[model samples]
Every structure is written in C-alpha cells, then in structure tokens.
Target: MANNFGRVVEVMVSNMLFSMDKYAIEGTIPFDNDLLPNESEIKLWNLSKDTISRIKRNETLMINAGYRGDVGVILHGFVSSVLTKREGVDAVTSIHVLDSQDLSKRKVKDITYAEGTLASYILKQMVGQLGLPIAQFELNQDYRYEEGYTASGEVTDIIGKVAKDCGTSAYINKGKVYIRNLRRGADDVFALSKGTGLIGSSEPFEEEKFKGYRIKSQLQYRITTASVVDLKCKDFEGRVHVRSGTHTFSRTGDFMTDVEAILP
Candidate 1:
C-alpha cells in the first residue's frame, strides 16, 4: 500500500544534478558539532574528459538520499579537494567536501555581548555575524556576563561556548544553522516500527558517559541531528534525541542511516 520502496540517491554540484554512473556518495552529519565539521567523500569511476574538467574545487555540493516516500537533502558542503587516480585502464576520482560552517574556523577578531542577555539572542548575533542561515533556534535561557563576554578565538569555539552556556547544541548542516535546546522535549517525527525499515533492535549504549541508543534503519533523510525519534522496538519504547548520524549511499543507490541518540 505504498507508492515506492526502492532507494534513490542524487548528488548535485553547484546546483546542477550529475549522473550517478559509476559514482557513489557517502558522509556523516553530526547533530552536536562541537568536534568536527560535516564532511563527505565522492568516488567517481571512468569519468569523461569533459566531466573531469568540470569537477572543480570550491564548488557547492548537495546530496539527497531517500527510500520510498521520504526524501530530503542529507548532506551539503563545499568541494574541498579533488584527487584523480588511474586504476588499470580507468581513471577514478575522489572529491572531498566540507560543511559550510568550516568557513567559521577563522578567529573572530572580537565579539562583545551585553549583560543578562538571552542565550538565543547571543546565538542569533553570532550566526548573523558569520552570515550563516538559521535553520532552527530554540534556546531561551538567559546568560549573564558579569564583566561582559568577549570572543577572541575561533568563531566555532565561541559559538560552542554559547551553546554550552545555554545547555544546547549548535551546528551548521547543509549551509543552515541549528541551535537546539537540550533540555526541551521534541515531538516525535515518525514512529519507526520493527517491520518497517527498522534494521535491527535498538540497544542501549554509553557515549561520552551519557546513556544513548544505537539505531540502524533503511536510508531516509527526514531525520537528522536534533530530530526526535520514537522507536517501537520490542526492547525499547521511548523517544530519543539524535546526537549524530551517518548516511551512506552505494553504487547501486542503496542507502542507510545509522544514528546515535540520547534519551530526552
């Protein structure tokens, strides 16, 4: 009683869709970006001379992976590097890409904040200064800087501090920024049933000394870091907030999303 049940993966460079012939795209997008930036590796086989020349550094990269009725952009970034290798008779190419937020790795000369400011206000000002799009903002706690807080390091580092002060997670994905409240409850987007795309039983795990769950499911792009999921496995039945996840696509267009989440 469904429309479709197969996998479809598409990659676009600089807003132009590219052929998937002998190509594969894969990457992980973290929910909590306090550590690394969103990145991906694209492998192209037997590229034509013209196509090879089209592949350039600094071009924008966009990837959408889905199964059946669910489809959305799962990865987006700038092409960081391109490498060509000859394998016997065919030339293979690998493209490395980095999230848009990677541009914020530079030190922000100076940033001043007023006393008794709302965490959301501080985050808004920070992202505005960096020119990053706002995907979502939920942080509302107030932050008081007795002597005023001044940012003098990497922009990402300063944003990370603001996130910690509000007890939230902040990061950029697909060229959009997200500032989520860790203490707030989220509505379950979808109920993952055991017989419906659920790859395996949800198991309890430990991550960073915090309780978490490891989830494996067929490829779908609607869920991302900060999205709340309701698992209906026989072993576990509750909501878990996604902390990080990996979306992988094969040469045949098959896709999978593996997520690590913590209880809300």
Candidate 2:
C-alpha cells in the first residue's frame, strides 16, 4: 500500500544513511523538476557556509500520484521546510497527507504526511534540490575527546579527534556532492543517529536565522507509508533525472505498490 511503502520508503531512505556514499558533492549545482516533483520558483539565499537555493510553493507538482488522479503540491515538504527556516526562525507546520484517499484500504495508495522538523532540514540538505546537480561540502565528525591529569606528563591531545571522518569543501568540486560531505546532502546521517521513518513540517511557527540554524527540540512523537512508481512527471529527465528501480515501476495501476519500494 502507498502508506505502507511511505513508511517503507522512509525505512529504506534511512537505511541509505549508513551507506553514505550514494551521492558525491560537487560545485556544479543543477536544479531539475523532473527528478524531484512539486516544483515552483526557486528562492536563492545566502548561508555562512554556502549559497542556498530554496524552492517556493505555489508551483505545479505532478508525480505518479496514482490512477485515481494527480496531486499538485505547491512544493515538496523538504522545499517547504527550507522556506519555513528562511521565513520563521524556529517553528514548523505540516500535514499528514493520506495518499490517494479514494483508493481501497487493501490497495497500496494509502499514505500520510506531516510537517517538517530538524530531521527534515537534514534530509533536505542531503537530498538537496531533486534536479539540482550535487553541491560541494565540508564534512565533520561530531566526536569529542577527554583529557586526564595524573600529575605526570599529560596524556596526548585526543579531544575531538574523529578517526575515519572527513569534511568536503564546496568551493573545490564546483558543487559536487560526495558521500562524505555533511552539509551537502546528509539527510540519512541524522536519521541513522535517531532511528525511524521521518516526518516534516512546512510552516514553522517561530522564525529566526542564525549562522545557519541551531535547534533544541521541544518534543512530540506522532505516527505515520511508496516506490516512486513510474513517476512519468515532466521536463525533468536524465541519468540522475531518470527513475531508478526494479520491480517494473510504472505510471499507472496500483499506485500504492508502485512507489512503495525504496530506490537501491
């Protein structure tokens, strides 16, 4: 079912985080509506680390919504969240979009969506704009070290030393995204750290912009499902633009089952 796959897709995407090498960061950033649905105009803004391109809502979005009909979103939740971050400093509002309400419950189209959250921002940065080429990045491991004193020659400086971790530089690759780049497209990193299917918010109640964004969450745990059927879509097409999956993803038929599976 769509809802089931929604959860499954979340699971699979989260699963990808551990792999962390699917995409590499580059300096050449490209934006395409075909790869990622729900596209409107883009709002380019400034970031301390890099230049950010935000997708605006009020745009036409057509995915493999289903045989029943199409869902025209102003913008995808990821885009909405970026806008929310820009507009409202620390607040997020969203919805639980039950996929294809008209379809049968036994069918696969049923799905639910909520507003964005901290994790959403992480994923947005990881996925970046769908069509946009990979971006450059700087990676860092969030590890810390401790120092001990025994009245003898002090222990070596091991504080904040991460063994196998590396950061990517955006200026070098011309916006190319490497699996190692944290700020580039590191959505899976946080999810792996957290563990669960992710939910997102479109409108944040409180808005503020600091160096980039710093968040300490006020908690609420609520519940939530597809492959990405053929996702025929429009203008957006290419290798990265092209849909990648097995199990014969299609543009029609049981919409739920089609997009239920996660890519790779």
Candidate 3:
C-alpha cells in the first residue's frame, strides 16, 4: 500500500497553474449520476492582487489533489462564480465551478431522426452538438424508434431521455459524457481495506429496493459514479457498484473520498 501521508494539490485556471504546496487551498467536489451537472467549491487563501484579478467567470478550472504519490485529477470544470472576501486579515477566494456547463445548458436545435434510428446514434449527435467528448457510451440496450424521434430542449435532458429509453443513465464526469448501465460498473476496480486506506467500518443502508454501504476512504480519484470497488471491512466484504461519491480536501486536515455503493 502506498503512503497516504503528504497532501498534494494543484489548481489551474485558464492554463495558469497554482501549486497548493505554496498556497493553501481547500474544497469539496461532488460527483453523482443524478442527470445533473456536478459542481465544486474551491477556496484559495491569500493570493496576490494580480492573481485574483485574472480569474473570471467561464474560465476553465482543473484541480488535481491527493497524497504525494497518489495525486490525480479530481475536478475539471468551468468557473461559474468567483467570490473574494477578507477574513481575519487573510484574503480568501472562493471559486464555484460547474462540470460541462456549456454542454448542460446548451439548447439543441429541433431535429427529427428517421424511423428505425438507433438511440445511441442520436445520443452521439446530441453530445457532438455541445462539442464535448464521450468518456463512455455503452448502453445496456439500444432503443430504436419506430415512428421517428424529435430531439429538442436542452441537450442534457435529451441525453437523459435517450438513456432512459435505452435502459441506462447518463451523466457528465470531468467534462465528458458517460451513458452507462447502472447494474454494471466500469472496468477498473479499486480494492479498499484497512491497509488500502479504508477508514473505519462501512455503514450499511437500504434505500428503497437498493441495499448498499456508505464508505469513506483516503481521497481516491478512481472511485466515481459507475466505478467498481472491492471493499473488505469488518461490517461488509464484497464488491459493490459506486453509485455516487464526493472527493473532499481541506488544509485543516481533512482529505477523503466518500461514496455510496450498491450490491451488483
């Protein structure tokens, strides 16, 4: 097991890099498959006047954070808002970002697909309209519209509809669109245990028909929505499908990834 001791963070805004090792930074980034864009709140402390002036709305923001050796990209999005204030003689800049902001809010032109058109093809077209790349587009079943289909309104909504028709779910992760089966997870599986950074015991919970556990571990970038994980704790031991999660880092000694997973 790699040492999860030293916290490392790097922030980039519009291609300008700011190392957290030099500047204190803290934030919470949440990821899920709720058919809505994921958002992040990043707080940077005591930056120079020129640095603060350069940050503007709609600029690209990418944050890479983890332990020294395990550091990876955790949040990639566009800045939606920037707020600065003075707290106890320190200047704090809070940057709020939205993943795939352009793609989520873009309204697709009304276009009717021909009869017998595959849902996957239409989904690709919608994503192409927003100019966002596809991370994964595997569907459990592809639906074919017999009477032709009309696509209108926001592209995110249309994608969600297409995913539902095809028996799956769609969501944006780190600026890429992913339409995947809920029952099956991604190919990469992370093993979590006491030696592998699993914190405490897994808490079991039942939500409607789903039975799963809420797990917390040292900040893991691999554990995202639709990712698979093999968890071994005193309370539970098995592989579960990650449904949703959050990767959080704070300078005041909090760095962890919390995820909700269900048995597959």
Cα RMSDs, all models: 3.0, 23.3, 1.7
Lowest-scoring 10 consecutive residues by lDDT in candidate 1? Answer: 21-30
1-264 per-residue lDDT for model 3 (tens digits): 744568888999965898867888888999998558777999999988888889999999998887777778888899999889999999999999998675646886779999999998999998887787888889899999999999999878898999999989888889887888866745688899989889988999898878999999988877788888899999778989888988888766678999999898
Q: Which runs of model 2 end up more than 4 angstroms from their true locations?
A: 1-132, 135-248, 251-264
TM-score, every prediction: 0.86, 0.16, 0.94
List, in order, the clash count of every candidate structure: 0, 65, 0
Q: List the candidate 1 regions with Cα displacement exceeding 4 Å.
A: 1-5, 21-32, 114-118, 182-188, 207-209
1-264 in candidate 2: lDDT tens per residue?
122131110101111211102211111111221112221222222232222222223222121111122222111222222332334542222211211111111121212223322222232233332223443223444222223211111111110111122222121011122223222242322110011211121111222421111111111011001111111112211111111111111122121211111221
lDDT digits (tens) for residues 196-232 of candidate 1: 5677688789767578788987765766776677777
lDDT agreement with native, every candidate: 0.69, 0.19, 0.86
Predicted structure 3: lDDT? 0.86
lDDT of 3 at 212: 94
lDDT of 2 at 45: 22
Q: Candidate 1: what lDDT?
A: 0.69
